[model samples]
Target: MNTQEHAVGQVHRDDISSRMGMWLFLFTELMLFGGMFFLYSVYRFTNAEAFHIAAKELNTLIGCFNTAILLTSSLTMALSITALQKDKKKLSIFFQLLTIILAFGFLVNKYFEWATKFDHGIYPGSDTLLAMESGEILFFGLYYVMTGLHGLHVVIGAALIAVMTRLTAKGIINKDSFVKLESAGLYWHLVDIIWIFLFPLFYLIA
Candidate 1:
């Protein structure tokens, strides 16, 4: 094959490699969260009452709002990909920015929820929390750990999207080259799906 053909073949291989690598990374992330979910199930089974009671303390309204925000963001992320693929560069950038804004809104709401809990002396290692029953304590422990970890993932996903937005704006991630944006969208969707599980588990359990 000619040099240009060889270069094109190498690019194709690299694209496949990038996708495979992203999938493998996503698998590892799922395993991490899946193990946490199993632990939560064991605890919930043993301490159903405490878990239920503790869950009631969570603000379902805020949780639902955040869920809606994330779900909408997922749609925007998908639309962004579609727009890019269709060669609508401006529209794609708009959707990407909108997705980022939605992400920020979700985080803001989450912060307020967490802050309220802290204000009420319900955070990890606090004296008030320590004074609670063992089951209740365990409930709060899992609540903080699980939700906090998920929040971290949201932050990371937003950061990745922000990078993708910048790249898209620069024409680096355009109709002809958008694997990075697609990967970012996949990650953002995963974050949203995880929250869908979390919202019911933590907010609606009560």
Candidate 2:
């Protein structure tokens, strides 16, 4: 093949390899969260009453608001990808910025909710929390660990999308070469899906 054809072939192979790598990374993330979910289920089963009580302590209103924010962010992320595919770079960047803003809103709400818990001395390993019953303590332990980990994912996903936003603005993630944006969208969606499960388990259990 000619040099030009060889270069094109290499690009295609690289794209495929990048996609496969992202998928593999996502699978590992799923496994990590899946194991945590399994442990949560077991703990919840054993401490159903305590779990219910602890769930009641969580601010459901804030939980619902964060859920809405994340759901909207996911939609915006998808729209960004769609716009990029249609060669609407400006629109794509708009959606990407909107997604990032929504993510920030979600984190802000989560911060306040967690702050309320801390104000009440309800955080994991606190003297107040440790003074509670075994079941209640277990419930709060899982709550802090799981929700905190999910929040970290949110931060990382938002940062990734922000980078994609800049790249898209620079025309690097245009229609012909937007796989990176797609991968970022996939990761963001995974973050949303994980929160969907977490919301019911931690906030709606009551």
Candidate 3:
């Protein structure tokens, strides 16, 4: 085989390696959250009434709105991938920017939700929360910890997408090497998926 052919083969292998590494990282993430979910489920089962009461305090409207936003962001993330694949650099960048905006919107909504909770004196270890039933306190504690972790993931995903957007603009991440963009999309989708479960569990389960 020619040297050029060998070089192409090597690049293809490198791409495969990069994708595999990302998938492995995602698997580890899933495992981490899976354990949390298991604990949440057990607690919910044991404290059914208190959990329901606690969940009722959450704003379902806001949760649903954020759900919609994240779903749309997932769509835009997919569109970004497709645009890059089609060699439409401008469209790809546009979609990436939209995804970032939607992510920020989600965070803004989250801030308001948490603020409302705090205003009601419902935060973890708050006097009001401490006065509540043990089960309700447990529910809120899990709620805060789980959602806070998910929010952190959202922030990280947004930052990664921002970097990807810059790379795309600079011609560093184009049709041939848009794998970084794809990785960011995958991570964003993972974040969205976690929120999907969280919305129903924390907002609608009541």
Return the clash pairs for model 2, or none: none
Give TM per candidate: 0.93, 0.93, 0.94
Which candidate has the top score in lDDT? 3
lDDT per residue (tens digit) for residues 144-169 in model 2:
89999999999999999999999999
User: How would you encode candidate 3's per-residue C-alpha lDDT over 1-206 as one tens digit per residue?
Assistant: 23333355434445666777898999998998999999899999999999998888999999999999999999999999999999999999999999999999999999999999999999987999999999999999999999999999999999999999999999999999888888888899999999989889899988
Q: In candidate 2, how many Å is residue 18 off?
A: 2.5
lDDT of 1: 0.90
lDDT of 1 at 91: 96
Candidate 1 segments exceeding 4 Å error: 1-13
The backbone clash count of each candidate, in order, is 0, 0, 0
> How many clashing residue pairs, candidate 1?
0
Error of 2 at 75 (Å): 0.2
Specify the highest-TM-score model's number: 3
Sorting all predicted structures by lDDT, with the top scorer first, yields 3, 2, 1
Candidate 1 per-residue lDDT over residues 1-206, each given as its tens digit: 13333354434435655777888888888999999999999999999998888888999899989999999999999999999999999999999899989999998998999999999999889999999887889988888898899999989999999899899888899898899999899888889999999889889999
lDDT of 2: 0.92
lDDT of each: 0.90, 0.92, 0.92
